[model samples]
Target: RSLAESLDAELLMYLAQRRITPGFLNEIDLFLRGHPELAEYTPDFVRRFNNARPLAAYRFFLKGYTRPARYVPGILPERDDQITLPHELPSVASTVDDELVDFFDGYEYRYDILRRIDDQVRALCNFLRSGGRLTWTQRLLVGLTLFGNPVDAYKHYEYNYQTEWLPHRYLPEHVVLSEVPKEPDYSVPTARVRTLDGADDKTRHTFLNTRRKMARANDAGV
Candidate 1:
């Protein structure tokens, strides 16, 4: 294979193993511009990384740029408990790919997404409850935090749908989920999951403070 092909393969591999952030996407954007066809190799990429990455997480990068990732039609459910993947994808995808990915036959990718969000929400809430602040990494993942809401699901769906992607991605699932997920977990499953749902005074104070701050930041259109 050519250098472009080799680099493309490696890039997808690393991305599947790790998550991406908005700031880091500036780097990936440079990559995508140089290799605009990078999106074309997704089938093979997915085949290899299926056990290493969340389907929605990887799709966030392939949207618009790849033909396989067509707009999903109303798959979100009424509850935030699980993401109901469509029984099938748009057939137009087979024509666009250099190879077809038959891996996503059903809900194989569902658990990890909820697990990913659950993790982020836990991390954010933990920091708040402990009177601790969001780490640099946590701040970078602000988009993935704040779960238990219908809106969070909506944004996550849009982010995964196509190439008009968001930058708050790319951290390895292990880091995002805290611990590594065991076998058959996320495939990229994380380690020990932790949450800070304390009723302590300090926890309450910090939680309110951060919540208001987040509200204001959202109002400021962050």
Candidate 2:
């Protein structure tokens, strides 16, 4: 049990460094729950893991960048601005080295490389969804590169931000009303007055002072 705990901690640290999505963590939790024998060893492991929310708090305390909405703002362009496929896409079979070929062959057992494939899978999904046309060869190459089961692919492609994982302060309407000032009235006399480009220094200073006073009054709710 002690050894398993230590190993799990190490794995969590590694996943944190790799910025693995919460969906992956949830899957792990579900797997653990399914096996009572394994769950017995780790005390409240799933609950504690969910509370820590490592995925949402990945790297910085900010939310995870795994959401498709965060990365893919809109339908991505079919091709680059040059109207050509990216150079990184493998062309001839020789373009892929033996080591990469071997990795793809045994990709099912390569959990360590999962983080690296996340972006590639996202790009492939976006490209396919955007009605981009890919040749049979191109599709085959991409499939080999991003080889994963339907579950893994679905988790990667449709990952959403888990609200419970985010910091409470980031929740909507959680902001302190007092700290957030109301919109100020823009009808101040100084704002209405337009100074000439070469206005005198005194005039400029007066204009600035009026603006500052208006801001202060608005902030003070006066």
Candidate 3:
């Protein structure tokens, strides 16, 4: 709820500054309310934003920049711009590597893009802490994720979807390391009977005989 409210407030601010339109604000609000994808990681954002390293927090934008980040906005095209992902992406083949590939997959650009706004929030928090002044654009950005930093915030989604969804969907179930089995092989029985409810006289007698022998052996200190 706090996150939704913060985003709405940011949208309003952006709308006021001409950085975003009322239509853009409405669409963003709808996106936040309707989409479960972004919500899943909001808790982490709130948590990490509070304890982020002061210097690391400042450098996180740069420190985590493996390549120029691509930006995408949801609100206004004029507000849209691409910053190279901080690092060079690895090649995509039989496998995808985070070290090489832009983990965000070019989804960051927008009029009020989730990623860009997220960055705005972190930069604002850092700026305020340092007594730095914000321009209209910067103020609008900071509100997007007032309690979160972009580097730590968006990565949760990338990691979650990549780890939780990709292996199960695109690759074989065995390839995915999940808390529970992604899909079960129907050819195998889900359950097995290791013991029988009833036994024949021969089996019962044999069991009793073995128990008796063991008891006698123990008694004799064998």
lDDT to native, each model: 0.35, 0.37, 0.34
Error of 1 at 170 (Å): 9.6
Name the better of 1 and 2 by TM-score.
1
Model 2, 1-222: lDDT tens digits are 121233355546645443343344454344334445423444354245445534322222122222121111122232333123444543222233322333245345434333334455446546866867665433432443343122223223223222222232122221112233334764433243445764534444456776775565455444
Off-target runs (Cα >4 Å) in candidate 3 are: 2-14, 46-222
Measured by TM-score, the strongest candidate is: 1
lDDT of 1: 0.35
Candidate 1 residue lDDT tens string, 64-100? 2311121122222223323222333122212222111
Superposition error at 162 for model 2 (Å) = 32
Give per-model TM-scores. Answer: 0.25, 0.22, 0.19
Q: Residues 106-214, candidate 3, lDDT per residue (tens digit)?
A: 5442223344434444555565667666654444333322222343233322322223233222222111112223346534221222336543334333456656644
